[model samples]
Target: MLNLVELPDPEPGDGQVLVEIDRVGVNYADTHQAENSYLSPSSLPLVPGGEVVGRTPDGRRVVALLNGGGGYAERAVADLPVAVDVPDGVDDTTALSFIVQGSTAWLLLRRSTHLEAGESVVVHAAAGGVGSIAVQLAKAWGAGRVIATASSAEKRALALELGADVAIDSRAEDMKGALIEANGGKRVDIVLDMTGGTVTDQSVASLAPFGRLGFYGMASRELPQAIGPGSLLAHSTTVAGMWLPHVFSLPGNVFSQAMGELFELAAAGTVRAVDGGVYGLSEARAAHEALRSRGTTGKLTLDPSR
Candidate 1:
């Protein structure tokens, strides 16, 4: 439903500055935005982009995250807080990844569940944008064991290389068994789930006592079974979810701190982006199709200059 029609360039509103975008992050949330199935509501004729790295009028390079979806265009009106100068040594796409995917990965452990050292962690979609980084971060932050699952062996191997203690096929027939087996016959202590449907059901069933699971993406377009009090009471499990826009309220310092931490990680070689590929502005539709195909690995981007 995307049309490459020319529209007048946007002007900065009050407290907003104009940015000539260098790179636009193509997030799974943007795909949901286009389909009108996002967690929140949207009307027709929307521009689909949540994060971008660009230059302001004075030529300061900055990273911006917009919930209003104007980033697919040549320019967007970014305000002070959601817009911050890109750190030294980080590329446009890598900075954009931190705004959404990287921050989400951090909050999944730091906020959603206080990851205790030595706790077993499982990361589904282990080669995708967030999962790939989560695998590395879990290890860097002191996880005892990290289990990574992906649909391909190359991805599983990549997870293993990124410090995962174990890797398994995401398409295992007995999902629960595969996870438990990968953990050396023990239930997982924490889980980060993006793939839904049976993958979620099996993961929930594989939770250890006092286990915690955080849901961020449902790329499979499948919802997990509704949970009841009985399900949690039996094992004392906890479940939580997060959306990035909610964290920007204290924008002056909130997300900025997270970006700083990720930048440090990047500088130390503790983490890096998995470049999925960059498409031209006119090829936004194609990019969404690639995401819907669910075959993309790492982070995909769009070049607004085209």
Candidate 2:
């Protein structure tokens, strides 16, 4: 169904570039789009992908973010400012996953919360795409303790292997208690939450004084509930909503510098690609089903050549 219709080749107007896509990262957003539950609805029969790793017409490897949904097919057009040169030794699969998930993790740890060495962070959904990258990035940023939450034993184990100091079964355990115990009885300095609903309350409660809670996704399928009146005042906690596109929209060289740092981390192996599955572009429906089932542990991608 994904390739039933072909999209016309996009032209680069002004400061834009047209890329022949190689691999497209399949994110939770793609699943949401496929189900028609995404934050922003796309036009019907729209191609469904946000980021792609491909080559320029001249064959320079690059990674670009698409404005419209056009990454599941052959080619896409992207703004030059948001596009970055893929580092040497980074393949298409790794580049596709790194553009969105890896950059978000880097911005959240290094820029958003200013996470410092010896501080602690708790990342929800630690086995998924963004979660897995966030786990390793937190450690690379010198976090003293990294606590991760997952629903299954296998995922919890994966989180530990990826650099988490502790992994708790969020579905069956007291998340707040486990986090506190993991941090030596002190509240964590930051909470990276993609899961919303009741998990927001737990994350708020888990923050230390002056701690920042970074919210990026709603994987729980519910809006974040309001915090109690006294809770915010008592804890002096701050909630930050992060959108990677917005981060890249800044003026000057902000976006370029950030992407450069993230690419460096990936090249050095401090941050690893979490692509757990790869599917042909025509199997997009199956990919969305797998993502919605919540059984997949890491990032998913589509190889257009297939």
Candidate 3:
């Protein structure tokens, strides 16, 4: 269903700015859109992308969020508010990292958890697009012990290099046990579970009394079992889910402030975007395959000028 076609350049309508894209972020959400599995399904004839870093007509470099898909093209139209100037130190790809994955990490750590110093946290898929950023942000925000879970040794190592105090193999036969052991032989204070299904239960069980687990994605493509009151009666734990699309819908300063903080963090070198690779725009198929393989780390970008 992925194809490359040539069309006339698109013009920006009211409240929209046409950007000459320099880098386009390839997100797992794009996969959901491609398969019509997204919470907000993509309509037919969609272009299939969400984030991009580009320059406007005035030549101001900016990172833009495009909900309706169109970033894969050489030129993209983004809302004026969604397109903001990139800081001096951040590159195009790193700037693209902010709008979705970076902001999501910010929201999860700053708004969702209110994580405090000396609190232990577990980040599943810790070397992933969003997970990678989450790991760094957790450490920057003063998480006492950061536990990361990944499928491979390299990924676990990557997690460690990204400020994780402990890195466990999520595919290990004794994953839960290993995670608990890494957390001082007890459940952690917080769990960032992007992989649902069995991990959901494991994450809940891996929480300490009054622990909190934030559920965001289901990259495993499996449905998690329902969490009943009985599941948390003993520990008094809490599990909450977040959909970024909905978060962006709220009208207020909360969204803008989070994004501003993300930019500041990147500028301060507290967190940096990890590049999996940059493929030509025509190589979108290969890009999607790389993402689906679950073998890539950090962020993958598409360059239309290649």
Candidate 4:
């Protein structure tokens, strides 16, 4: 049912910019919104995308996070605060990756887990947009040993290339045992659990004493089982949850600080934006399917000009 339609150009209100979008970052949340399963209910007749790279009316190229969801089109409106200049060395697609996936990776380590140098960590869906960046950022931030999980060998290889110390098949029957073995017979300090459901509980069980489990997205669409407080207390482990929408809704300079750190890393090449696939704007349905299929690696993007 995806259709391209003609609409009037959006006018920029105060503190808003009319951006001519060149590329848009395809995200799992977009699929959630489309299916009406997103935690934050998007209004009806919504244009389904949140991040894009575009030029403002005055001709400044920028990466923008569209709070109102219009990133699927050739033009969209962006708030001034969330819009930042794309670095000279970065392309539109890479820059578009930074606004959501990049910052999410940064926040998982920097804010939620407070991961320290030499701490062993596990990242699920390690070849994905956020997980790919997370793998790089974990190394850059001094993680001692990073273990990643992906469905395919190619994706696992990509995770290793991105800086994961070890990569394991996520569908392994003995996932917890595999993670333990990967950490050298010891449990990991942190688990960045993106694929909720059963994985969340397993991640909690795989934690070392005083470990932290940082749960974010539930791309698996499986109902997450609850973690028993007694079990966590026995191991002195903590389970922390983060939703990007909640992070973005916070007041003060939190969003800017997190994004600034990620952008700096991207500019310096300490972290790279992994490119998975690209599709024309008119092929948005295909883009969403690609995102959900788990058949692609890196960041998926949409080119309006294509």
Candidate 5:
């Protein structure tokens, strides 16, 4: 359904600027948005993209977040405040990763749970755009143990290389046991997961007292059963939900600060978003298919010029 079309160029509104699109960050959210199942509803003639790396009229290369979804085309309207300058010498893919996924991962640790030093942390979808970065950031930020869960052997190896102390199968029959077993037979202090359903149930059960669960996505069709106050009281656990755009609303230029730090880490090669695959503008549908298939790892990008 993501067919190529030509239309009048989009005009910028107040506080926005037109960007000549270069590279688009294709996220799992796009797949849900395409099916009209995203947190926000989609309208007719929707363009299923949210982040991109492009150049503004001033010729400055930047990575931008499109609040209302217009990143797949040759141009998009970027809110100036949400667009940040891409570091010199960074490629389009790395720059784009530093936006949505990178920012989300950083906030997950810094804000979502205020991850404490020496706390054992778990990162589900360990080889994903957000999960991949979260693993390294947690370790760099002083997590005692970083347990990663991925669906494949290759991804598990990648997570291990990215500073994860342990990697377990995400589809394990006894997810909670697998998590505790991987953590040296002890409950974890923090868990970061976009996966819902049974995996979420296990994550919640695997938490130590006063542990926190940072829920971000619903890669699985079903949601986690973690909202019961009674269960929370008994477990001494907390659930913190994260919607990336909402992070921008926090005081003190929350998102911009996080992006700046993540860029520094990425530039230093301290952390990197895994490279999934790149597709052309016309291949947007195919990209979504690959993401939903759960076989792709790291970050998937789109080249609009192709």
Candidate 6:
């Protein structure tokens, strides 16, 4: 049996870094990539992963957000500018989970939505990786109320444990009504939605006047239908899409500054990791299955060392 398979270990030709992966963070993107439904076209037989925590040749632990797929392995090539030093004391697992989801949440809350200290924010799939981190970050950022929507009682409890002020069973009741109850009849200032389709519509409905909605992923695996301009104008709400790759594309110190802020928050324990379980690289198929079945919460990882 071939314990290890060799693929192209192309040298970091220009502004790229060669990383020996220690942990690969599994997300909804990985599940979609495995299913051939990721928004961007992918190369066939590709290694499907978005983020990784690894060590550079200099022995420094770093996190990389790959441009394409290749994180489900022992090593990979990543853009040098997108790689950041992992904060000291932040373990490999947490570091991997924080790069993609944590940075996305941080940008959405701070830059996209411009979340105010006393405003309210609603997060969908609150028990999952991005949502869990978003909930905590929102609370730490001084959101008066953080409402999380989950599909089960267990996930709801987990969201509360992670720092949500209130958890709603999105599968059991009217989302708008549940949100109103959580916010004392006040419309939310921001809605961080990963689940598209009807959930996107509901999130739009739950926003206050002039509120902002940050759309990230389509967790439901369906393309989100358009929110008509008429409806948006009526509500005075604005909707924006967030992809971590875009943030990294900006010039100058933009990406570095954002990553620095996230690492600081993680080191201070203000944003806790929601690592659900760890699997070996050889068990990637099972990890994909677990994510597809929606049977796990928080961040799932592939430990290269087993």
Name the top lDDT candidate.
5
Flag clash pairs in model 6. none
Q: Which pairs clash in the backbone of model 4?
A: none
Q: What is the TM-score of each candidate against the true structure?
A: 0.97, 0.93, 0.96, 0.96, 0.98, 0.93
lDDT per residue for candidate 6 within 1-306, as digits (tens), equals 113356776577688888998889988888777777777876666778878888888787899888787888888888887788887788876777678888788888977899999999999889888888899999998998999988889999999998888898877457777777788888888999988887888778878899899999887877666588987997799999987778856677766776787778888878888878999888888887887676788889988887
Give one digit per residue, the lDDT tens place, for model 4 in 179-245. 9999999998999987878788788888999999888878999866758878889789988888876
Q: What's the lDDT for residue 173 in model 4?
A: 78
Q: Whole-model lDDT for model 3 versus the true structure?
A: 0.86
**Candidate 5 residues 1-306, lDDT tens each?**
678888789999999989998899999999888889989999878888999888999898989999889898999999999889988978888877779888888988988888999999999999989998899999889999999999999999999999999998898989989989988999889999899998888888888989999999999989776557876787799889999989866888988899889888888889877778889999998998898888988899998878
Top candidate (TM-score):
5
Candidate 3: segments with Cα more than 4 A from true spot: none
TM-score of 4: 0.96
Candidate 5 residue 285 Cα shift, in angstroms, is 0.7
Model 4 segments beyond 4 Å from truth? 249-252
RMSD of 1: 1.4
- Least well predicted 10-residue stretch by lDDT in candidate 1: 245-254
User: Model 2, stretches more than 4 Å misplaced?
Assistant: 1-3
lDDT of each: 0.87, 0.82, 0.86, 0.87, 0.89, 0.83
The better candidate by lDDT, 2 or 5, is: 5
| Cα lDDT of model 3 by residue, 38-104, tens digit | 7886788879998888889999998988858888889989989888888787887787777898888
- Model 1 lDDT tens row, 1-306: 888878899888888889888999998988898988899877877887888898899989999877588889888888877888887789977887788999999989888878999999999988888998999899999999999998888888888988899999999989889988989999999999988888988888899999998988788889888565888887898988777777766436667778889999999999998888999999999999998887888899999878
Off by over 4 Å in 6: 1-8
Task: Give the lDDT of residue 132 in candidate 3.
Answer: 94
Candidate RMSDs in Å, in order, are 1.4, 1.8, 1.4, 1.3, 1.1, 2.4
lDDT of 6: 0.83
